[model samples]
Target: MIEQSLQGRRAFILQNTTLEPPPHTPELALHVASEITPIWKMTEEALEEIGLPPPFWAFAWAGGQALARYTLDNPQIVTGHGVVDFASGSGIVAIAAKKAGAARVLAADIDPFCEAATELNAQANGVEVDFTAENLLDAPPPAWASVILAGDICYEKPLAERVMAWLGQARAAGATVLIGDPGRSYFPRQGLTKLAEYQVPTTRELEDMEVKKTAVWKLP
Candidate 1:
């Protein structure tokens, strides 16, 4: 069964990674791979053997770290509102929103492994975040979510375009949409109102530099 496979994958992730605090957001801790290459290789092998996607949930990305820090510092943004963290890898931002006093927080990702990782990470941080493993690309933002948070979602062109359009729709529908991006190639140059920026420390294995100038933006 799918649930059984997800449990096995979760065990594998826990076995391979260590629970530690992310560099930029030390207030939160997650189970993350210590070295990037080893996990990258292991995930590749997993892909060949069991059709697993890349293990992006095993690390705290720059955009997510920046967003989490911003949310914690600016609790008024999410407090008393229902939030949805789109592509919620490791559930870092979702946990931050919950800690910031959001009425409800939902972490949604298409990858089942990410759901497992999110659940574990939320528990580690002493936060309650619901998880949904749904591919919501074609769907409109849920009416219950007053805020939709997306992080590091502009890596690819097609996905970037689709997410931007969907977030635009969400914005028009009276939901406040926020995006955290590290200036990826496909990040939109327009239609965003910059809110905050952070020099997020990151691993060179994942990015070209040791620190990424990341920013949080509001969808227009």
Candidate 2:
């Protein structure tokens, strides 16, 4: 029954959105909403009807774009390693990791809709990425993950704190941890080493500015 419901939701999302390449990462395509307001309203209505969270899986956020661009350019960072993309959203970073030749890629998110979106986007890019709806933050980092990727995850204060702690643990366990951020209020100002930065093009409907100076950081 849950599988059927997810399929129905995936169909609804594909019908309402376009499959296009993001501005910064042109090599990969995803099912993306053209306008933020209409999709946001539809997502809100869907949440009211089904008790789901907002549909963040419908857009390629600035931080994700910057991370994806960096991953594609610096393929050696993920090559031949097992990668886990946390808060996977549209699966942009996961796709990039797979394209970069990661031994395996898992896209993890709490939202069931994100699992469906990740699968669809992975197929579109001709790469295989496993999807998990589990909230992996509730437990220790998986032993199989040799590298962990997080993109645009520091929006809320509490969630950001929790994720940063978990990511720190992962780093201590010897897994390379990387984060893509647009300097949200919740992002920790300390303990991160910057790797790359990009002026990611974004829509004003979702962000205050048209271009976000996003950066990818390594957690130590």
TM-score of 2: 0.94
Candidate 1 stretches greater than 4 Å from native:
1-4, 44-53
Clashing pairs in 2: none
Per-residue accuracy of model 1 over 1-220 as CA lDDT, tens digit each: 2224767778877888999999989999999997777886776666455545556799999999999999999999999999999999889999999999999999999876788798889889998899999887868889999999999998889989999998888899999998999999999968689999999999987899999999999987
Say what the RMSD of model 1 is.
Answer: 2.1
In order of appearance, the predictions have TM-scores of: 0.94, 0.94
**Residue 13 deviation, candidate 1, in Å?**
1.6
Q: Which stretches of candidate 2 lie over 4 Å from their true place?
A: 1-4, 47-53
Each prediction's RMSD to truth = 2.1, 2.0
Which candidate number would show the highest TM-score if scored against the true structure?
2
